[model samples]
Target: MDLREKERKTVEILRALKKVNYPGYSRDIVSFGFLKKIEVYDDDRVFIDLEISTQKEEVIEQIKEKVQEEIGKIGWIKGLELSVREREIFRRQKIPIKGKTVAIYSTKGGVGKSSIATQLAYTFSVLGLKSSLLDLDVYGPSIPKMTGTQDSEPTSYDGQHIIPVEKEGVRIMSLGYMAKGDTPVIWRGPLVIKAFRTLIFSTHWPDTDVLVIDLPPGSGDIQLSLAQEVNIDGIVMVTTPQDIALEDVRRGISMYRKLEVPILGIVENMSWFTCDSCGKKHFIFGKGGGELLSKVYNMELLGQIPFDYELLELADRGKIYVLEKKNSEVAQAFLSIAKKIIDLLKISV
Candidate 1:
C-alpha cells in the first residue's frame, strides 16, 4: 500500500519471476535478459515488459500465462498489465559440445545408475579417450562425492562460464558441488530445470569424446527438459534383474521411444552375486531381465555386471574402482559396456 512496501513487493515479484525457466532454453527469462522492465504503483497496480526471441505465438502466450500465474499467487496485487515483445536476438542459443552425450536413466531409484555412470566415464578415460561426467540429478547430485570432489565447487570466470572439476582423468560437474555439506536441495520443478540447464550449458566442459550424464531416476521434469534442450546421441538404461525394476525400465524405454531418441542398450546391473568362499554365481535379483528387455526392444545387452562388495566399498570412498581394480570382474564389465557404447556411437576411442 505504501511506496516503500510497494517497491519491496515489486522487487520480490521480479525475483520470483526470474526463477521461472522456459523448458527448452538453458537460462531463465531474467538470465536471458528477456524481462525488460517492471513498474509498481502505490495503488497496488503493476506493469511488466518482457522481450523474448522466439517468433512462435504459442511460446509467447505460454510465457505470458506463466507470468500471470506467478503474479496471481500474490493476492495483494490488485491489477496487472503485461507486455511481451519478440526479438530475434533474444532467442535461445545452443552451446556446442564436441562430444557425444549419453544419458544414463532409470525409471526407479536405487538402481546404482550414478555408480555405473561414474565407472563408465572412468572406463572411457582408461581406454585413452577424453570423457566427462555430469550429475544432472538436481535433487540428489552424487557425482561430486563419487568422484572425490565433494569438498570442491566449480570455478567460474567473468561470472558466467564455469570450469568443471577434474578427477581421475575425467572432467566432472554436479549440483552437489554447489550445496553445503549434506544439505538437501529443496527446489521446485522450475528451479531444478534451470539448475540442470546451467550445469549442462554454462559449464566449460573440455573437448570430451563422450559425456555421460547421470540423470535422477524416473521419467520426470528433468528427463523431459533434457529431451527438449540437448541433442542426446543415445540413452543407456540401467536396471536391476528384478521384474519390478524391469517394469520401470520398460516405461523408461517407451518414453525415450516417444521422444525418438535412440536407446543405445540396456545394462543389467547387479545381475547376480558371486560368492567369495565357493566361487559360485547366484542370481540374487532374477535371471535374464536385461536379456529379456533387450530382446523385446531389439536393443543390445551391453553388459551384465555382477554384484560385488568391493565395488561398493570403493564407491563409498569416492573412488572409481575401474582404475584401482582394473583386473576385477566388475571393473571388466564396466569396460566392456563402455566399449560397446563407443562402438554403438561410432566414436573413435
Candidate 2:
C-alpha cells in the first residue's frame, strides 16, 4: 500500500481503540484528543503517541495494548511503536484544603464503607485535628444523612464557590443535597465525573489537617477518576469477615495496587458480635478475614469493628458514635483506627 493509504489505515486502527469499563464515554483515543501524534513511515512502521490523563498503569496499558492489537491486525504493519505521556487535567484543579486526603473504598456494596468513612473523619476531628469528609458516593450519598445534615443544603458565598456544611466538627459535602427526597441519581459516567469534579474544586473547605473521602462501592469510574485527579495520601479498605466480601476486597486491593495508591490498612467491619447476657464474643460473620487478607497483602489490620445494634442505630440516626457512645467498644475501635491512620500518614494534628 502507498504511504497515504497506510496512514489512513493507521488512523482507522487508532480510532477503533475504545476504553473498556468506562461507561457513558464512547469516544476512542483518536477522537478523545488523546492521540497526540501518529506517524506512518514508508517502511510500514507506525509510531503513535498518547497523552493520557491518568497515571494508572492498567489504564495506560489497556490503551497501548488495544492500539497495538488493532495495528497488528494489519499484517503488513511490520513495526509498531507506542508512547503514552501522563497529562492529567484534573490535577490542575487545586483543592484549596491544606490537608492530607484519604479515600475509603470497597469492591462490594453494603459493607459499611460510608459508616467507617464518616466515623473515621469524626474521630480525627475528635482528636483535635481539623478534618473534613467528602462523600463521593454520587449515586447513594449517605454522609449528609449520616452526619445529620440531610435536611441542610450547602451555600455559596460568591455564587461560584460552595461552602461545605459542618456537622460535629467535620465539614461535609455530598451529592445527597442535590438530589430530591428518595430520588435516584440517574446520571451517566461522564456526568458523575463532572459532579465529582465540581464537588472537589468548587467547595470551600476550611483549613483541614485530614480530608477523608467516602468513595462509592466498587472499583469503577469514581475510583479511577479520583486516582487520576488528586494525589491521595492513602486509602483504607473496608470489608466484612466473610468469604463473599473478602473476594471483592481482594479485587479492591488489586485495583489500588494497579493505580499505585498506597493502602494504609484494612478495617474489618461487622467482624464479630458480643452477647449482652453472656458477655461472650460470637464469630458472627466467620473470623479473621481482615487479618488474613492484611497478612497476605502485607498491610496492617487497622482494627476490627464488632457488630452492635446500638452502633448501627447511631449510624442510621446520623449520630457520631464516637461522641455519643464514648465508652463503647465500637467507639474505641474507631478511635484506635483513626490514631493508626494519623500515625501511618504522620499528619500533625
Candidate 3:
C-alpha cells in the first residue's frame, strides 16, 4: 500500500477503536498514546512505548491488547512492542476530611449498585457538594457509562498519582477506565484486592462532601479490602423486593455489621413497575421485602424506587434520569432518595 493509503488505513483503524473499546475515559487512552510515542507503520503495524506508573502488570497488558486490536484490522506489519516502567510507591499523607466515603455492596450481582452510587454522586454534586466516585468493580465496571463521561480518562499529576475523572460536577475513577476491551478480567483474589487498594489510596480524590464507592457485589475479597483499608463512613446495601434478594441482603448487612461499618439504610430497586396506560403502580416482584429486611435488621428503609423502564434505559445509555425526564415519577423518586441519603450522611444541604 502507498503511504497515503496506509495513513488512511490507520485513521480507519483508530475510528474502529472508537466503536469497539469500552466507553470509559478515552482521553486517557489518547493522552497515553500521545505521551508514549505511538507510531503507525506503513505496513500497518504500530509501535508503542508506555511508562505507566502503577505496579499492576494487568493494566499494562490491557493497554497493549487494546492498541493492537485498534490497529490489527488493516494489514500485517512487523513490529509491535511496549515497555512499561513500574512506580508503585505512592506517598502517604494525612487523611483529609472534606467529605465522607460511602460504599454500596450487595450479596450478589444485578442489584443496581452502580445506578444508585452514580446517582448519589451526581445528586451530591447538584446540591453544590464536591463529590467523587471510586468504582472498585474491576471485573465489571459501569460507572463511566452511567455518568456519560466515557472517553474521558484521568490524567497523572506529578508523574506519580492519577487525577480523578470529573463529569458534570462529580469526580470519578474506575477499573473500567483502565480496561482495554470486553475481555473478561480473570484476576485472582489477591490481585483484585491489591487493585482495589490502589484505586482507593493512590488516586488524588478532590475535597468533597462524599465519595461513593461502587463496590463489587458480594462480601468478597474486594469488599473486605475496602472495609479494612479505607475508613469508610458507612455502607448502603441495595436489594430488590424479592424473598431471595432479601435473603442476600441479610447476609450483606451481617457482613457490614461484622466489619463494624454503619448501615446507612436500604434502597429497594424495582420495588414496583409503573403502568403506562393507567398511571398506576404494580408490584410485580411481590412486596415488603425491603421493609421486612429493614425491620428485622433494625435499619431504616431509605427509599423504594419503582421499576421504571425509562430509568433503566437512561442508565443503560449513560444519561442521568433527572436530566432526561425530570417530571417522571422515577426522577422524583430518586430526588427524594437523594435527599434522604443526604440526611443520613448528615451532610449540609
Candidate 4:
C-alpha cells in the first residue's frame, strides 16, 4: 500500500483533532474533555464519539463541522462516523413511565421494525403484564394504524399530562394519533426534536412492567436525544436477513454503544417463509445475517422471525398477528423473542 493510503492510528487522529476548537470557545474540545472515544476499526474507518456538556444545536453543529473538516484532512481516511452526544442543558423532568424501557431500533426503514415492536408490546400484555408502546418514529408513525387507534385522540383531564390510548391491555401513544387521518409529519429538525421531547415528557405514562419504544429509523438527533434524556434499560435491534439491512444495523449498534445504551439482543425479521403446500422453509432474504451479526457483536440471537405473507394484510388492517395466529411459527417467533427480552432485562412480567 502507498504511504499516504496507510491506515490512520488513534494517536494520528488525536494529533489532527488538536486543531478543532469548540464553537465560540478558544479551547479545543479534546482539552475540554468532550472526546470520549476515538476508534479506528474495520477497513481503516474511524468512529469518533464526543460527549459535550451543552444542548445548543448551533454549538453541536459547529463542533461537528469543524471536526469533520479537520478529520477529512487525513488523506487516507476511507470512512468517518462522528457521534456528538449533547447533555441536557438543564436538569429536565424525567418521563412518567415506570420500570424498564426496551427500545426497538433500526437505522433503515421498512424492515418490519414497527411490526416487531407492536407484537412485542402485545405479547407482554398477553403474559398478564402492564405494557406500554411509544412510537418515536416521527416521520412515519405507524403505531396508531397498527394498533387501530387512528380514530382516537389523546385526552387529558389535568391538561398537563396527556393520556395514552389503550388497546388489548397495552397503553400506546404516537404522533399518528394527532394527525388528521393518514396525514404525514413534515416538520423540520428543530420542530421534530421538540415533538419528541413533548411526547416523552407530556404523556402520563402509567406504571408498567415494561415500555417498548419504536425508535425512528437512523442514528440521528432523535436517538441521541432520547438516550441522553431517558433511562433505556436495553435495546432490541431489528433487521432483515439481508446484507443491505445488516449494514445499517451495524451503524445503529455503534451509536447506541457509544451512548452506553445496553444492547439486549437482535431480532432478525423476515428470515424465512414456510410454504404451506410444500412444508419447506425457504430463505427469502438470504440466510444467517442475524446470526452473523450476533456472533460478530457478541449479542444474543434473540430470534429469527419468519415472513408470514398474511401478516402484511393483517397488520395493514390493524389486526394483531400474534393474537390472530397464536399457534403460528411467526407468532411463536415474536412471543419467544418477548420472553427472551424479559429474561435478559430481568423485567417483572
In model 2, where do residues sit more than 4 Å from their true spots? 1-94, 245-247
Question: Which tens-of-lDDT digit does each residue in 195-303 have in candidate 4?
Answer: 8987888878768788889987888888888877777888988878887554567777876787677999989999999999999999978988888778656699999
- Sort all candidates by TM-score, best to worst: 4, 2, 1, 3
lDDT of 1 by residue, 43-130 (tens): 6667677878888998888888888888888888889878776763323334457878899988879888999999999999999999
Overall lDDT per candidate, in order of appearance: 0.82, 0.80, 0.71, 0.83
Q: Global CA lDDT of candidate 4, please?
A: 0.83
Clashing pairs in 2: none
Candidate 1: list runs displaced more than 4 Å: 1-95, 245-247
Considering summed lDDT, which 10 consecutive residues are worst modelled in model 2? Answer: 15-24
Which runs in model 4 stand beyond 4 Å of their true positions?
A: 1-93, 245-247
The prediction achieving the highest TM-score against the true structure is 4
Each model's TM-score, in the order given? Answer: 0.72, 0.74, 0.70, 0.77
Q: Which stretches of candidate 3 lie over 4 Å from their true place?
A: 1-97, 245-247
lDDT of 3 at 159: 64
Question: Using lDDT as the measure, what is the rank order of every candidate, best first?
Answer: 4, 1, 2, 3
Model 3 over residues 1-349: C-alpha lDDT tens digits? 5557666755665564444332245455444442333445444455444445556677767766776665565456575544444533324332344777788877878878998888777777766778888888888888888877768888896866778888767788987788746775669778897777778767787566788889878877887766656678878878888885544665566556545568888888889998989978899988887897676566888888888887778887888876667677766777787777778878886
